[model samples]
Target: MAIVLTVRDSSGLKLAALATGFVMASLDVTVVNVAGSAIQQQLHASLSELTWIVDGYVLVFASLLMLAGGLANRFGARAVYLAGMAVFFAASLACALAPTAGVLIAARLVQGAGAALFMPSSLSLLVFSFPDKRQRTRMLGLWSAIVATSAALGPTLGGLLVSAFSWPSIFLLNLPIGVAGILLTRRCIPPVGGRRVRLAVPGHVLWIAALAALSFALIEGPRLGWLARPVLAAYVVLGFAAAALVTRERRAEHVVMPWNLFRGAGFTGANLVGFAFNFAVYGGMFMLSLYFQHARGAGPFLAGLELLPMTIWFPLGNLVYSRIAGRIPNGVLLTVFLLVAGVASLAMAGMSTDTPYWVLAVAVAVANVGAGIISPGMTAALVEFAGVAHANVAGAVLNANRQIGTLVGVAAMSVVLGTVTDWNRGPGLSFLLLGGAYLAGAAGAWWLIARSERQARNVRR
Candidate 1:
């Protein structure tokens, strides 16, 4: 009994260490939304520059995640995780001390690279630490809860920090978290052995180039005009890079992406769900944060407070998922949660500047609850499909798709905001887009996931 208790306590510590990395990463994703206006005003940044500041980290993070997974497989997860945390710590300091928008954006890109390194390895470590399926699922739930809590706190905390100090305070918040994560990880998590894996360098380079071109086209198109030479060139570059990436991926001996993973219907569907989920949730969050501050004339602190009702439900939803995860089929759960989010988001599409705050809050809260549940559900589905052998690669693929969704979502919202000019119309239209993304996820879940589960059950019978 004593030995069992000791094992459980040790596992708990390992879980905490893993959660720390996610908490910092998830916090940065949302916290920057609240800090957008502040960063813009302080840096004297244009709207496009502000978008770059936000997307720069995600762009790099998304691009390198698959490579990070390969690195973990080659160099051992523990070593790679530690290295990533150290990089993140240094980059966070650079971000906080950045003197201008260009410097901040550059630092953010580096910070994203660090996050990419740690993010996939953290999951690989978690899967290693909890070998039992039931235990791992439970830990995944708790992990999601902890990370969701940080995401929930991000905007409010950023608001308070920005209100009291400055925009850089948000980046500075990561310093202590990074230090604690590194220390706890070193103390609690045991090292995992690496296998021989080929790291495809050229494939990753093409991937980065493709994403950069796409980002430049999406972000700069509004400011520079879609027909501008640079914008046109970026589109052309994006097309060429994407074609080259596909061709290389097909021919590469060592591919960054594990193309074989998508062979399972469940895996393909789960990736689709991941992409749409992030597209809607992160994009909607970005839109709402700006709407509260720029449209409703709320200060940073007030905007944070106003967002509290919407953000707080994420943890609650995670807790609810933990309770019901075993009882319900993942496919059913995913479908229902996504439908709830989609309908709620669509309901918000009619909102005007004069719409009742409570009404908007209620709808957003519902959508958020659905989103929160979808996060763990989607993760568990993908992980189960991949099994232990492919855990790291599966995690990387899901996260890369999600981050790409994030990049596109934010850029799409930027386009909406830029083109519409009217704050009221822009946010409503943004919700419309969010709703469509969620519905698309629901369709994927229902068609692919549900059918796959049925077929599997029939085979067993």
Candidate 2:
């Protein structure tokens, strides 16, 4: 009875700590977006510099997540989680104090490294903390809600911080949360055993190079002209790095992205959908911020308020979907959600300077509902398709792909808008491309779902 009560008493504190880490991770994805204008003005940043400030963090975070998972497995999750929080806290301080775009980008990179360490470890801790199926589901549901809410609310929170204070306030916001999470984790979470795994060094190096070069080429392509010598060189480097990554991974026994996971129908489809989701959604969010501020001439606070429609639906939709997630087939749910998002993108594509705010709000709200639906379903499909032993690595790969999608999405849209002298045409073109990508993702999800069903029937026969 005493043990049961202790578990019950400490569970909430543990949940708070774990969710704090996740919130910090998710918040950074969008918070910096709202602060873009302020950061630009204060630092006298170029467009490429601003892009790097945002993409640099995600690039490092995505590149190192797999290695971070391995580290978590080698060291205990509790120890690694605390260490990650400490690093994240220190990095946040660095971000808040950065004086130049170069300094900010470098700090953001270190912050991503710290985030990479904690994210997977925090998930591992959550899994170990709740051994019971029901409790696990509830905890996961709570975790999902918190993460969704953070992502949803990030822009508004960032706008408020940047409006009332300055851009640095955005990074400063993470300080108190990080400190509290570290203290709670040290006090409340129990130590768990870890496994020994080999680090895939060659694969890591190749991936990091490939992604960084690709991002650089994409961001600089529009500014430098696509065929410029530097842009061409970056593309060449990207191609070589990508080819080498494939070769190195194929030959390695302990790989960062195990090719076998891709063989499963649901796993492949989940990753594809994850990529498309981030590409369109996050990219669109960045574009929307620019449109509101630059094109529409809205202030930071009002621009965030304009986005409230979509943000509000994210958490509410997640709550509603969690209740039905078990009853629905993941493939079907994923397909439907992708379709919804695609449709929303299409709706947004018709916008012009004359387009009313209500019309845009409706379209964005639909997309938020799609995001809410797909997030948890993607996780479920990964676990179901990969099985328990492979779930961790499967998740890391999916998330990495998702972050790459985010980088590509943002860079691509920025390139389009940057190159086109006409604001009226360029932004709309980006939306059209995003809509097409979302539909392609929907088709892929449907194919995987049908294949899985057929395989299930064959097995029964």
The model with the greatest TM-score is 1
Instruction: List model 1 lDDT by residue over 86-117, tens digit each.
Output: 99889999999999999999999999999999
How do the predictions measure up, each by TM-score?
A: 0.97, 0.94
Residues 358-461, candidate 2, lDDT per residue (tens digit)? 88788877766767777767766676677655545665777788888888888888887888746677777888878877887788788985468557769989
Best by lDDT: 1
RMSD of each predicted structure: 2.7, 2.9
Off by over 4 Å in 2: 1-10, 449-461
Model 2 vs. true fold: TM: 0.94
lDDT over C-alpha atoms for residue 141 of model 1 = 89
